[model samples]
Target: MGKLKSYQKQFQTLLDKGIDNAEIRHKRMVTRPFDFAEKLEKEAKSYSFKSVRQAHNQYAKSLYSSLRTLNERANGYAADLIARIDKEAAAAGAKSGNSKQPAKKTSTRRSTTAKKTASSQSSRGTASTSTASA
Candidate 1:
């Protein structure tokens, strides 16, 4: 139990940190190109046409590189989070003596069938009572 709690705390911390880092990275990834574009637009009048085109091309390449980097980092973060969750879940299951195999899932179809039968029986009873009164 204590070990489970420790894992839980560690998972939470990692999740929080991951979220913060992702948010920061996402903001930079989203905003940097726009900021650069704005700067380019501002400086466009001072530079010749060729230089402006070159700058735009460079910006596009950098933006693509950054996007790729961000994607890789996000994937890494997701993998880390999944690993932490699996570790925590395994610890919890072990503590509960369920680590040997997955738990059996109860069938919802049985419950739905039972409910339909119950509703049909109740409706029949009501109909019979109404006929008797009539």
Candidate 2:
């Protein structure tokens, strides 16, 4: 009801017009949860024999439960969601776009190991070539 201070005039106008569009419906939908939350907070401060944090936590839990009853919870959202999924899939060794994801200043030790492995392979190849010719 505290949050409703802004909308008292608007609600009155709607009552007079008798039109219920998404805007009016949406306002009611949003305000209802807030009103429920405020009531819960007041009850926590008044009736409960508990610590402030404990009462506050209970209030939050109740508020979330009320909100869940109000709205449709869903799986995913927009283009950013798709892009994030693609990044995670690529990280799990699935192929993604060629555009590189910048990694931080990596371990030089790994690069050194890679260089050593390449040099060892080249030396082995050279030895094999000479042995074959001989």
Candidate topping lDDT = 1
lDDT of 1 at 41: 88
lDDT of 1 by residue, 49-71 (tens): 89879989999999999999999
Give the 10-residue window scoring lowest on summed lDDT in candidate 1.
125-134
Model 2: per-residue lDDT, tens digit, 1-134? Answer: 86697598788987777756766888988998999999989877776465777868999999999787655333334556888988897776645455566675466766776666666766777545543333
Model 2: residues >4 Å from true position, as ranges?
Answer: 1-20, 47-134
TM-score of 1: 0.39
Would you give me the overall lDDT of model 2? 0.71
TM-score of each: 0.39, 0.22
Residue pairs of candidate 2 with colliding backbone atoms? none
